[model samples]
Target: MRTSPRAHARVALAAGAGLTLALLVPGAAGAATGTPNVPTDLYNAYQPCATDPNAPLVVAGRGSGVTVEGIPRHTSPSAYYLTEQFRYWPVADPTQIATVERTWSTPGYEATADLPGLVDGSTYAWQARTVDPSNGAASDWTASCYVLADDTFPSQPPTVVSPNYPEDRSSQGGAPIHLELGSNGVSDIVGFQYSWNGVFSVSGADIGEHGIPHYNDPFDGPRSAVRADTLGGTASVDLMPPSPSWIQDLYVRSVDRAMNPSPTYHYRFRINVDAPKITKLSNAPYGKPATFKFTPDAGVQAASPVVSYTITRFGSDDPVVLPAEPSGVATTTLSLAPGETMTVSSLSANGWTSQRNWWRDETDTTTTVTSAQFPANTSSPAAPGSFHFAPKTETSQIASYTYAFGWSDAPTTVPAGKKGELDVTWTPPYSGWYYLVVHATTKDGVQLADTYYWFGVN
Candidate 1:
C-alpha cells in the first residue's frame, strides 16, 4: 500500500534495527522511497486575468497550441535529481488528452510542456506533479487549472459614430473629432482596434534568433487597442486625421478576450479646414485697379477643387463673387481706396468656404516736395545753408508745409508762397547727423504722405 514520506519515516524510527533497509530499499516494491515535492507557480499564455486564479483561460482559436510551465518545489535530500509530469484533459470527456514528462536538472527547477490538442469551444483542465527519477516515486497531483477555449470573434464590429463629423459628407478638418464606440450586443468584446486611412495590421514584434529579443527590437505589436468597460464594452477616443483637407476612411474592429478580431467597419468622411491662399500684388497702388490672385489651398485642391472666390472689401458689405479657372485659381482687378482693407475666400466644389485671407494696399502716391540746397543730403555746421522746398509741378496747390527739424522737437506750420514754394534758414546747434520731416497739405485740408529728409552736419 502507498504511504506518505512522514508515515514511512515514523515506521523507520520505530524499528531501529531495520533503519538500513528502509533507507536502502528505494528500488524494491512497496518500498518507502520519498515522493518528490509538488510543482508550483504554473504559467501559460492562455491564462487570462492572471491576478485572479479562479479566472478561466481564453485561447485565440481552435487547434491552437499553448506552452505550460511550472517550478518544481525542492524536496528533502537535495542531491536527488527530479523530473516533472504534466497531464491535460477536456472537462467534457473523461479520457486523458495527453501526458508529458520533462527532466529539468537545471538549478531553477523549471519544467515546460506543450499542449497541442486544444479545440474550439472546449474547456480544458491541467495539472502537474514532481517525480523522483531513481525510484519512480511521485508527488500528489496538483489542483486542476481550468481554461475556456474560444474561437469565435465578437458577433459584430464595434459601432462607431462621430458627432462633429457626418458619414459621407465634408466637414471642417484640422481639429479633433469625437468618436463613440460601442459593442452591438456582443458582450464578449473587451477592447477596440482602429487605424486611420483604413490601414490595419495585426503583426507582432519580429522574433530574433533563439527566440530572444534583440537589443533594438520593438517591444510589442505594430497595432494598438483601446480598452472598454468590462461589462458594457463601450469607449470613446478623439481622432484627428492629417491636417490640410483629408478625405479618408477610419477603420475600426472589435477585439474579444481571446484577442480575436471582428470584421472591419469603415467610417468614411471628408474634411475641409484650410484657409484659401491669397497672392495679391505687393504694394498695390492706392485708388487704382490692381490684380489680386486667389487660389485654393493644397489640401482643398486635392480633395475638393475651388470653384470660385469671394472678395469682400472693407467698409462695403457687398462681396464680389468671381468664378475660378480650371486650375482652381481666380484673379480680379479692383480699386482699393486709401486706408482700406480686403479679405478673400475660396469656395470648393463641395460647397465648403475656407477661412478668409486678409489683404491691404500700402502704396504711397501723395504730392512730394523736393529740397534744392540739400540735394546732396549733407551739410556742415560752419556753412549753414538755407533749406529750399519746391513742388514738382507748377499746378501744385499746396497751401502750407509742416516741418520738424529734430525727432524730439515739435512741428512748426508755415504758409507756402503763391508759387507753391518755401524757404527756411536753420543754424545747427551741434555737429551731428539730423533728420527733417515735412508734410504738405492742400487747400482742401487733405494731408499728403510725409517726406523724410536726412542731412549730416560735420
Candidate 2:
C-alpha cells in the first residue's frame, strides 16, 4: 500500500525481522485506543548534496521523521535498495522535472520510499537517492515510509527465531503435543510453566509428594517460554483429561520472565480414552493376603487409554469394577472365591460392555507365582512382603505413578458395578506404589496373585 501526503494513516501490522509494513490508515494500527496520523504536505523540492566525502549517500526525503530507506550499515547486503525516484511532489505540480531525488535518476523518473528511523518502535516517510562516484547519478525521491515494530510499551518480547515464534501448541487427551521451540536469542532461562485449559494438575499423579514437577509463578525471571530441557528440537508431553472425555477447544500459552506471552495457540482434538490394560496376573509381594489383593501384570495401551475396569473370580457373573472406591481413574482389588473363577477386562469410556478383555476366569487353586518369578519390590522382605508394580501411563503429566502394595488383613472387596481399594504401605526395598498382578496366576499351587505392576520409581 502506498501513502500520499494527504491523509496521515497508519494501520496495525505485524513485522518480521527483514520485512517492514506501513499502515495507511488515518491513524496508527493497534492503537485501538488512539487516533491515526494525518498526512502532511511535503513540497520541499530536494535535499542538497552531502558535504561529507561520501558520494553514494544522498539526503533522505523530508517529513516529521525523514529517515533512511533501510537499516544503515557500512556496506549493503546483496539486495539492499540503493535509492528511488518520485513523480512531481505535492502531486499537484504538473511540469516539475519529474523530481529526481539525487539528480542521479533519469529524466521523467519517479521514486517512493518507507523507512524505520532511530526509534525502535516507530516509522517515518522520506525519499532517498544513491550517488555514484563515476557519474553522480542521483535517483528520484521515494516516499511512503513505515516502521517495523514497537514492543517497548508492556515489555520486550522475546526474539524468537522464525517458526516456533509462538510459545505453546494445543492437543487432546490421547494425542499429546510435540513441542519444538528455539530459544537462541534468550538467555538466563530459569524454566517455563505450561498451562493447558488451566495449569497442569500439580498435586496428584504429577510430582506427587516427591519434590519434583514443582511450580512457583509469576515465574519472576527471564526463562524460555517452553521448558529449559526442551531445546533439543523435540519434547513429548501427554495430554490428559481436564474434562477427560469431554472435548473442548483447548489452547496453550507460555510467557517469559518479562511476562511477555506468545499469542494463545489452539487446536481441536478429542481424548481417545480406553480402559487400562491388565497384562498379567499374580499375588501381592507385601500387601495383605490374596483375599485383599490379587496381582495382575497390567499395562495401558500406548495408543489407547483404558480408564476403568472390572475384576471378579472365574465363572462369577458378578464382576465388580476395579478402583473399589474409585474417585478418578483407578485400579481395584477383587476378593477371591476358593473354587470360583475370575475375569478382568478393560472398560470402555462411553460405559462398559464385553468388548474389551484384560484377564479372565482363572481359578485360585490353579494359580501360582514362583518365589523367583515375583518382582522384589513386593516379595523381597517377607515380613513386609516387598513388591514392585510397573505402572505406565499414556499421559505426559501425572497419573500412572501410584502403586497399591502391602498386606491388608481384610482383602478390600470390589463391590458389584464398582471397584475396590488397594492398601498403601511404604516399606523397605520398595519406595513407591504397587498393585497385584492378576495375570501371573497359573494352574499350579494356589498363589492366586502376585505384585507385578507397570511403572517407574523416582
Candidate 3:
C-alpha cells in the first residue's frame, strides 16, 4: 500500500552498540550525524528510536548494512503516521530489550528512545513492528531479528594453547591433539564448557553437556582445573587431544555456566591448531640474580606478556615472564650463582595465577618437623609424639610417614615423645613399634637432628 516515509525498528541480541559513519559528500551537502539511516540490508536495521539526533548515524556490524521495515502511510495531508515499537521477542525470552521508534510519515520518519540491553550467556529471539498513518491505514508488522549468517557457525572454536600433555585427548592414543586458549583483548575467563565429536571441541553452550575434557593421558590424570582467566588474558583452558583417537567432532567455549557466554569479547579453543613451542629453557648469568631466557623453535606471540619464573637464591625479588608473541613461547629472567638453584614456575599474567602458580614453599615449619617433643602433661602417661612436614606440592601418591618412639615395641609409625619422665607424645597412626633413636645427623642433615632430637621417656 502507498505510505509516507517513517522510522524503522531494530531488534538485536545486544543493544548497547551504535555507530556514526562519515559521508564522502561536502560538510554542507552531507547528512547530519544521527539522522534517518539507510542500509543495504533492511532486515537487521530498524530505527532505534523515534525523532533521534537529526545528524545521520552510520551502522556497522556483520551482514553488510542495516535495513528499515514497516514504512508508515500518511495519516493526513499535513501529518504522517510515525510507525514504531520496541525491539523484542514474541514471548519474553532471555534477552535485553528496549523501546524503538517505529513510525511512518508523509515527508519522513524518525525516533528517539533508549536502547535495550540483553543478559550474557542467554538465547534471545527478536522481531520488529511499526505504526504509521500515511494512507489513512498502517501496514502490518514485519519479522526481523532472525538475521542469517553468511558463513556457517564455527564448528571448531578457538582454544587455550599450552600446558597440555600427550595423553589429554585419548581414543586409541598416539600423540593426542593438544589445544590451549588465551585472551589478550579481554579480562580472564573461567570454567570452560567444551565438547568433542572425536576431533574437535565445540563451545558457547550454556549447559556443560556435549563438552569434553582434554585428558589424553592415563598417567597425566586429573589436574586441578587451572583458571584460565588468571593470566593477563582472560581465563583459558589447555589440553592435549589423545593420540590414536580420532577427534572428529570437538568444541569448547568457556563461561562460568559452561557454554553460556557473557562478554562479546572472549577467546575460544580449537584443536589441530598449532602454535609456538618452547623447546629449550635456561637461565644465563647463573649469578646471584640470574636472567633466564628461552629460545622457542617456533616464534613467540606478538605480545610481551610476563609469566612468573621462580628460582632459589639467598634472597631476591620475583619477576613476571613475558610472551614473545601470540604463538606462545614465553620467557623471563632469574639471578643465581654457585651453590644456588632457582625453581622455575609460571604465574598468571594477571593476579589470578598468584593463588595457584606464583608462590613456592622451600621450607616447612608445620611440615618438616621430623621429630618433636611436647611438655609431659598429667592427661596421659605417654607424652604425645609429634613431627611436622610441609604439604606435598607435586606428588599424588599415598604418603606414609613413620615416627619411632623410645617406648614402642612394634612399628610406632607416629607417636608422641617424653623426656627422662615416663610420659610421651607422638603422631597419630599409633599402631607400629617405635624406638627413641638418638638421631646423630644434626647440622649434617640441615641441622634437623639437633633441633629435632631428644631423649625419649620409657
Tens digit per residue, CA lDDT, model 3, 1-458? 01112212323322322321211111112112212212111222332312222222222223422333333223233433243443543223434343444322222322222223332222333434433322222234443343211212222333444333322342221123344554433333334444443222222111111111111211123532334545223444433432212233344443331222333223222333222222224432212233344332211111223233333233557534454433333554443332443333322233111111222222221223344453222122244565443222211211233334454434333222221112234553443333343221111122112122333343
Lowest lDDT 10-mer window, candidate 1?
A: 10-19
lDDT top scorer: 1
**Each prediction's whole-model lDDT (CA):** 0.63, 0.30, 0.30
* TM-score of every candidate relative to the true structure: 0.46, 0.22, 0.24
| Local error of candidate 2 at residue 175 (angstroms) | 7.2
For each candidate, C-alpha RMSD in Å? Answer: 18.4, 23.4, 19.1
Report the error of model 3 at residue 244, Å: 22
Q: List the pairs of residues colliding in candidate 1.
A: none
Tens-digit per-residue lDDT, 16-67, candidate 2: 2111231111211121221212112222212222222222121223232222
Best by TM-score: 1
TM-score between candidate 2 and the true structure: 0.22
Once model 3 is optimally superposed onto the true structure by TM-score, how far is the C-alpha of residue 284 displaced, in angstroms? 18
Better of 1 and 2 by TM-score: 1
Q: Report the lDDT tens digits of candidate 1 across residue range 1-458.
A: 11222221211111211111121213323213445677776655513213333567665535526555565554555534455666778878858557765553321344555566678778788787776656767778787877667778777888999887888888765335677889878888877878876665442222132222112111134434577877447988876554334576788988776677788899988766467777765444334467778877886676568888888888888998999998898887786654468888777776666667777655442435444445447664545567776554432566788888888879998988887778888776777777888876656565656777787787
Evaluate candidate 1 by giving its C-alpha RMSD to the native, one decimal.
18.4
